[model samples]
Target: MRFIINILCCILAFSSCTEIKKYHSIHAGPKPIAVVIERNPGIRVTGSETPLSVLYENGTLIYSEQSEADIPFYMKKELEPEDFKILKNEICMTEKFKKLRNSYNLCPNILGSTTVEIYMSDGKNSKAVSVYGYGIELEKIHDRIPYPDKNDKLPDEFRRIFRKLTGLNFIEAEKWTPDYIEIMIWPYGNAPEKSANWPSGWPSLSHPLTRKRGDSYSLYMPGLEKNDLNDFLDNLKPKQAVLINGDKWSVDCRFVFPGEPLWMKAFNKMQ
Candidate 1:
């Protein structure tokens, strides 16, 4: 509980702070060395939202994943020193990523195509690159590389690093909970005859909850604990229609860092 309070204090103090400051607010926690996000920015199933994985300096990895299940959750694993060392060595040795520009063609307007965004930071400096139509078989529209760093496929060096980082060495991981779970709710037009009533202690849906960084509306369930959230929605299923305020609303939820709002709002504003 005290740890949660610290996280909150860090957030409040750094509220509206720069992206780097906010990203590293958890003082005692390891700073993220790499982050891979398969961004769709649209509504998602309970456990299948974007922001694929975050790997930290201390070899700790936290990621969002669930298999054919509702009520999304996170997993945490600590890598061995040698394993982390090898990964870090490879990232440091890779020169192309550093030379490449900060971002590629974002393709934000095009729907249904997943954009892969990679963020790498070494405590002092950070680089973020976005790949358009990642994981899709895309042929280059033009032979010449365009300015502003556009690429048809994931670059070789970047792909190598991405694969290694995401290829987790350990399969045994414990469930990890973040400080907050963000939820977006909107009235469902075709709610079924039988649906779970909104949990009593959960936030009120009628009251306007602020929308978040992406295309949809999302809000952090303030002071909502993991156990309570799990207990509240245990009976629900993915795409389960929720009834609240005498109206039906579909709920989509994802985990958020304490200061995620700062970057999230910026993302909403970006192309």
Candidate 2:
């Protein structure tokens, strides 16, 4: 009777494990977030390249200065098709947060709309105002060395991958003469150093040369897309919610920036 009891216990344990696996697989997918850009205004454009800090809703800064600090969180656009598989394999081998694979998937809603507030002091009028609201998209980093010269700011394959994964278009800006060029791109975190085509020190680094702030880099690029600009302005959450209530908010700039034209169209379309 004791031996039969042991057999029954083993059967129950195996059944429990199988059921757990089925439950996890059923819930294995990414979560979606509703991202809207409420307000965005143009500012006195400067050519200086500076790495800005991105703060999350919880105020937990999800970025680190190190290259590999938060690999999974940073490289949504950089991962190749096969690299994702390799990442899973590595996680399985290490068993470090292996259960997390079932719990989390990288979704666009995770990185909410980013508001860019610039404190510009022209030695006279010191003011802090909203500049741009960076929309969520997988952006490709380029090299500073070939600014206004690189044939393709973003490679076709990379753009295709971003579209497939994010359901958003990764628009490439044409070459333009801008001061202080900085280029940083990402590769599949699992497959780093694949080719010399990629830039060094992606997502975070010591200087502007090493920093790449998502699709924010695209704003500085030349060509503008209707959706990209629209998405950007929507993230600002502008205080211009009412017009007749005598809520006359002052705009930072008299004229719109070069990129604002496309963004303005997007805003009007939503209205």
lDDT of each: 0.60, 0.27
Question: Lowest-scoring 10 consecutive residues by lDDT in candidate 2?
Answer: 249-258
State how far residue 10 of model 2 sits from its true place (Å).
2.9
How high a TM-score does candidate 2 get? 0.17
| TM-scores for every candidate against the unseen true structure | 0.61, 0.17
**Best prediction by lDDT:** 1
Off by over 4 Å in 1: 1-30, 41-48, 64-74, 92-94, 105-111, 136-151, 187-196, 205-248, 257-270
Model 2 spans with C-alpha error above 4 angstroms: 1-9, 21-156, 164-271
In the range 7-105, model 2's lDDT, one tens digit per residue, is 999999997787556333322332211111212223222322122211111211111122365412111122344654553243211222211111111
lDDT of 1 by residue, 1-271 (tens): 9999999989977754544453344222555677776666454553234466777878887776656865456678887899778877777435788886545554444567666666777767766766766632232332243433432444677666666655654579887767656676666658655777877766663333443344334445643475666676666776567776576667766666433332343334444
Which candidate number maximizes TM-score? 1
